[model samples]
Target: MGTKIPISVLVVIHTPDLRVLLLERADHPGFWQSVTGSVDGADEPLAETCRREVLEETGIDSAAHVLTDWQLQNRYEIYPHWRHRYPEGVTHNVEHVFGLMVPDAVPVTLAPREHLAFAWLPWQEAAGRCFSWSNAEAIRSLPARAAAW
Candidate 1:
């Protein structure tokens, strides 16, 4: 069997108005996060992985949105229960961060197998409620990053 790629991408989809989009995980009901997916193969670059994942998970075209590479990555152990998706002895993953800027907060179509629901909330509240620390951190960094541009 082929080895699982430890690298992945977490994309925060949001609007210029500070409204962040979140998707509830299908497997973990209340656990909400941004668009996320693993690199399917070793040849995919991280940036391409980011763009591809956002589209697959959210049905939003990355080219039509502002997809930014935050140049940040987080390495964390895979939760024991979810480790079956990886190869034996694989204990952690490296997640790259990205931000996809839509013009405004709007209804999104989620991949049913991956997510069950979607919500748009102001950045502050969105940051406060994300199930993942890395997701919250990315939301918290939005204002300053958006302002700088």
Candidate 2:
């Protein structure tokens, strides 16, 4: 695989009622997270990256929903086990946050190679189940964030 960019998007897909969608990683059976992926190229817009990831990972077209760039960003260390996907010496990542609000909790088609299963749960429970701290933190912010939307 080619080296991935150290910058990425973390999209919290949720319903108007605050139910969040979580996908279980194929590489790590029980590890769950929101829709995420690196920017395809340096020139790609972050909003496009966010929409692309949501569609690619969960088959949900973010453009059809109320996709909002929360303008929140988090810098976090790349997990040791997954660091090899990036260039050598890349130990951290910058994640841009976004929120995709659908009308309700709906079915999702998981990209089998990237995710094994999926679930829609209350935002609090979804936050608790996320494997990444940033993902969890984003989920935890859903209520307040949605309120401002």
Candidate 3:
């Protein structure tokens, strides 16, 4: 099996009105988060990683929407259960933040192996529902960030 990289992308998919799309992880049921995935290779561009993850997990072609790199990065410890996906001694990950703005709350086709369910919630509730602090923080910043866009 191929090892995952320590770098990943967290793409917060949302609608114009600040509704955020969150996915329930299949591996950890009830744990919801934004579209996230590790870089496929050392050379993969972060933007492409974001687009690929959004498409793979939500069946949303992010290119058709307004996908923006927020220029934010967070370093967090890897969850013990998921650490096996990386190489030994890889205990932390650097996650880049991104946002994808859709015209409306569209239906998503979740990947069975990665996600079990999905929801479109108001930004505040979405932030509360997210299992990751970085994901929640990103969602909470949407209103201000969207205003500046």
Candidate 4:
């Protein structure tokens, strides 16, 4: 497998009413998060990475919905356990944030290998359930972000 790039995208999938979709990591049962993945290659666009991860993780075609680049980014230390996925000595990842707005809480088809379950919850509740601070912050911003859209 190729070493993962430290640059990634975090796509917060939600509904117009502020219900956020979160996925349970198959490898870490209780750890839930939004759709996240590194770019396929150095040349891949962040927007394309967001679209690919959204569809790959939730089986939701981002092209069919309103996908908005929130222009937010976060840099955080990579969890020790996941460091092996990246290049040697890499310690952090820079994540670009995006939001996908569906009309309502839509059913999702989770990729069994990557995710075990999925839920659509109110933004506040969803934020509380997220394991990653960055993910939670993004969900918390939904009210303001949705308001502007």
Best by lDDT: 3
Q: Alpha carbon lDDT of residue 95, candidate 2?
A: 96
> Candidate 3 has which clashing residue pairs, if any?
none
Clashing pairs in 2: none
lDDT of each: 0.87, 0.91, 0.93, 0.92
Score candidate 3 by lDDT: 0.93
lDDT of 4 by residue, 1-149 (tens): 23999999999999888999999999999999999999999999998998899988988988999988899999999988889998899999999999999998877999999999999999999999999999999999999876776
Candidate 1 residues 7-108, lDDT tens each?
889998888998999999999999988888899899998778888887788878788777888999999988888788888889999999988889987667
Error of 1 at 31 (Å): 0.6
TM-score of each: 0.94, 0.95, 0.96, 0.97
Query: What RMSD does model 2 have?
Result: 1.3
| Residue lDDT tens for model 2, 106-136 | 7799999999999999999999999899999
Model 3: per-residue lDDT, tens digit, 1-149? 22889999999999989999999999899999999988999999999999999989999998899989999999999988878888988999999999999999987998999999999999999999998999999999999998897
- Candidate ranking (lDDT, best to worst): 3, 4, 2, 1
Model 1 clashing residue pairs (backbone) = none
lDDT of 1 at 102: 90
* Candidate 4: residue 13 Cα off by (Å): 0.5
